[model samples]
Target: MSVRDFAHFIAIDWSGARGARHKAIAMAVADAAGGPPVLVRRQRGWSRAEILEVLTDGLPANSLVGLDLGIALPFADRGAYFPDWDQSPPDARALWSLVDEMCAEDDHLCAGGFVDHPQASAYFRRHGAREGARFAPEGQTGGRGRFRVTERAQEAIGCKPYSNFNLVGAAQVGKSSLTGMRVLHRLGGRVPVWPIDPLPGEGSVVVEIYTTIAAIAAGRTASRSKMRDFAELNAALANLGSPPVAGDGAIDDHASDALLTAAWLRVAAHDPAMWLPAGLTPEIARTEGWTFGVA
Candidate 1:
């Protein structure tokens, strides 16, 4: 496939926490031509639907959208996303379909339905002391649960990642991942998702990204990746060779995440090595999916 010279790079710091309009859902954009990343702001904050609208109708052609979420669950480690379950989907696309179908009634694209599903709940670590039987770390009493191969690679690169099966705790991402799958399914090929869909000759494409990778590339430690003000953020932007945005004082960490990652994407997207990681076999790409920067 020919390499695409994407015209824009967008980063979305997504949220899974309950709410109609999430303060944590932040969006930012960087023009590939040059300059600092800018936040895509709204007076009342962003809703999941609004992000979907931008993806479907508002985005410029040849944009590279980086969504900060796990696109799929751990499959290679367990041989199935839901082992011993009848409805376990065979691949990421089907998995997205399953999540969307199950979560159809979940307003705001929330994943509460899938988390509480009779069979599906058994595979997840949920809140209120509801750790499913399979939630135990395999061959161990307790620890982080199963991880996709790409996640293991992420750890290898010094980025701490959490199991997407985990629904409780502040660091867990199961809710967000499941919610993102619904959006991917709804995307319906309007914009291709990398790995899941091969890159086209010319056009926009979406890729799953772990924002922590961008933070690490900007010389920030994973533990201190969250930036709360313009001063701290501009430092990281400088590290990525991006000009500073105009701002100061307290800012949402989610906003900082989106802005910094947008700038990071603009620089990182051009690297040929970033697209092909050793861990991303065709099977793994179809099932577990790779984070864009893990290599």
Candidate 2:
């Protein structure tokens, strides 16, 4: 859909620090129609609660808010490196096995098994403690142990009892790959989630969000090639106006712009002539073969 069709477009740059400095930079681009993207809001040092409040309050119900954080799978490494290896913890293993069995019964979800090890099982059980168990150690109190075990048993063959907002991408560098995998898993193997390479000298989170939006707008899945093409498209678009940068050696601002370009590209693809500028069309750009749909 075109920008005009969307109620609002949101971009969030997350940060984990104390006070406002730790808050994320959020930008909302409204559908001005035939005009440049309007920066309706730009806030800094926004806490998680503030961000969520603003997001829920400002945007329309149907508006799509593209966040730089991983909103499905919170932990990196798929919780694999939670000080427990080889085997899944008892609670985790049991819960996972149930999930697998349920998936087996349903054709929609994929099936998988956990590592078969006693220590690993114990660790998994301890790690995925229930509400009451969270405060008490795994086996500390009978109430905590029974409650956690019962909860694990209750969800043995389906999704775990958790919320999506808890799943944010890796806060530190050098963990994108692992973080991406966990994010995918948290998405329930359905929606398309792209894992992008980190931007040089800048936080990778922004780049990841940009790439994902671009790919979605293009009606395509992402890859290295598409990302490069997006960069080129951003440069081309920027060239159309007063340059956002002076020389070729400038900080890449393509991340957010690329997402806009991709959104426009989707608009163009639906009605090629409408979104294309004079003498600048998708065909001329040779992006016809660039499919954005998931495999």
* Candidate 1 residue pairs in clash (backbone atoms < 3 Å): none
Task: List per-prediction Cα lDDT, in the order shown.
Answer: 0.89, 0.30
Predicted candidate 1 versus true structure: per-residue lDDT over 114-183, tens digit per residue: 9888988887888888888887656764478888999999999899999999888988888888888888
lDDT of 2 by residue, 52-142 (tens): 4454344443343444432221122233222333332232223323334433432212221221233323322222332221222334542
Q: What lDDT would candidate 1 get against the real structure?
A: 0.89
Clashes of 2: 24
The RMSD (Cα, Å) of candidate 1 is 1.1
Candidate 2 achieves a global lDDT of 0.30
What's model 2's TM-score? 0.34
Which segments of model 2 are wrong by more than 4 Å?
A: 1-5, 22-24, 30-34, 43-45, 74-295
Worst 10 residues of 2 by lDDT: 286-295
Best by TM-score: 1
TM-score of each: 0.97, 0.34
